[model samples]
Target chain A: SAVISQKPSRDICQRGTSLTIQCQVDSQVTMMFWYRQQPGQSLTLIATANQGSEATYESGFVIDKFPISRPNLTFSTLTVSNMSPEDSSIYLCSVVGTGPLAGYYNEQFFGPGTRLTVL
Target chain B: SQQGEEDPQALSIQEGENATMNCSYKTSINNLQWYRQNSGRGLVHLILIRSNEREKHSGRLRVTLDTSKKSSSLLITASRAADTASYFCATQNQGGSEKLVFGKGTKLTVNP
Candidate 1:
């Protein structure tokens, strides 16, 4: 399985401040996805990031509020802009592992996630 | 948005007992998967059952998908204390893409 890491394991920011969460994969992958888990809620897909293209955001999630960037196959960043208390949630990024021997061939390996708290 | 709901939002059982969690989704899926997440950690993929398949097992975990009902169930047998975690069911929407839609998950606590 690919080794995935996310920066700023956690952070506390005041309202209106923006925070960028970074996700890095040890190996290059074709698709990287970002998901958000609000308190006591299910995981929601924020967007899908493909290298060298604009991210495809899901319904109820806008580019202006949650922007994403994929500079290469091994890395991506998700930024939460104009944060509010409701924006506080655990943000996670995952990648499809390469090769059949990597974990479950069809499974996604996720980062530990970045916990954000907005006051 | 989430794909569907997981029943018995929370469950508590004794070790060595069998724990079952059911998931219901809204759309056709190419495949349905079960994942386990210990508190404060990332999710770990458990098993995946394709739409064509009815049941699949991996060690202590057994998953069944009923396409007709658009529902799935995950059974963990011989549960141990370490089996305590939140179990989520995710599905790849039938559009042929691999985007996964996850359910709220069932929180299971196996006591020793």
Candidate 2:
């Protein structure tokens, strides 16, 4: 199992403001992803944080709204730009561990998550 | 393009009893996985069952996959209060992106 942590555990931002959440992994990982969980909803994949390249966003999400950067194997950042009340959700960072179980299961390990409340 | 759907949106049970959650997905998948979330926090991966495998077990957690039915089920034996959480099932498509598509999830409340 991999240990992951996120900055700004919880934050309250005004509408139109932007906030960037940082994710750090204890070990180098090849696949890192960003996800959004709205109130009373399931997790939605926002984008795939690719190292040294633009993130691969899912449908209904764009770089303009959610910009992500994976500078290295152990770190990534996601910026919520021009935030709105609808964007108020729990943002999570996830990565596939390089443990012995990796061969048996490609399960993902997630950060604690950043809870953003846009007022 | 939601791929998975979990039924019985919520469940309540007494401790020591067993709890079951079912999930169905559309399209062919390489593997199906179950995840648990406490409150609104990050999810914890519980177990994964590949398309080729019919069943898998990790401790007290049991997962079964039926590719012919495009559905899967998760069973927790002797549930405990600490097991109260939202359970979600995710599907990894046969090809393309390695992303896991999550379902709505079933909120399980194991009362002590």
Candidate 3:
């Protein structure tokens, strides 16, 4: 299993400000993704953070709002731009496990998550 | 417009009892996965059942898939208070970039 960690476990930012959440994995991973979980709602994919390339965003989400960067296999970052109360949610980074343990299911390992509160 | 939908939005059970949650999806899938989240935290993968397979088990978790009905169920035996959390079902489409469509979760509360 891969150990994933995210920076600034929780933060409060003013509207119109941007905060970058960092994710670091203990080992190399094949695929990295970003997701957002709103209060009392299910998780939604924000984008696929590809290594050394632009991210692939899901519907209703765009590069201008959620910019992602994956410089290497072990690290990635997600920046939530133009903060608003609606944007306040839990941001998580996940990686596809490639080792023997996770091969059967291709299970995803998730970081602790960054709880953002936009005021 | 979510791909998956879970039934019985919330469930409360006594410890040592069994808990069952059902999920239904719309399209052909490569696999169905079960995940658990506690107190609005990151999810933990519980188990995965492939499209071709009917059932899979892990520890206290049992997952069954019925492709004909486009549904799946997760059964947890001997539930514990620590097992209280929200459970979500995710589907991976037959052909895609490994993205998962999640369902509205079933929140389980086990009373000790």
Global lDDT of each model?
Answer: 0.89, 0.91, 0.91
Best-to-worst order by DockQ is 2, 3, 1
Q: Of 1 and 2, which scores higher on TM-score?
A: 2
- In candidate 1, stretches whose alpha carbon ends up further than 4 angstroms from where it belongs are A100-105
Tens digit of per-residue lDDT, candidate 1, span A27-70: 87767999999887778999999789899998899999988999
Return the candidate ranking by TM-score, descending.
3, 2, 1
For every model in order, the fraction of real contacts preserved is 0.62, 0.72, 0.62
When 2 and 3 are scored with DockQ, the better candidate is 2
Query: Candidate 3 on B1-112: residue-level lDDT in tens?
Result: 4788998799999999999999999999999989999998888889989999999999999999999999999999999999999999999888866888899999999999
- How many Å off is the CA of B61 in candidate 2? 0.8
For model 1, residues B2-110, the per-residue Cα lDDT tens digits are: 8989998999999999999999999988888898888857888799899999999999999999999999999999999999999999998887567899998999999
Candidate 2 at residue B45, lDDT?
Answer: 82
Per-residue lDDT of B61-93 in model 2, one digit per residue for the tens? 999999999999999999999999999999889
Error (Å) of candidate 3 at residue A18 is: 0.3
lDDT tens digits, residue span A66-98, model 2: 999999989999999999999999999988756
Q: Pairs clashing in candidate 2? A: none
In order of appearance, the predictions have TM-scores of 0.95, 0.96, 0.97
Q: Is the docking of candidate 1 incorrect, acceptable, medium or high quality?
A: medium
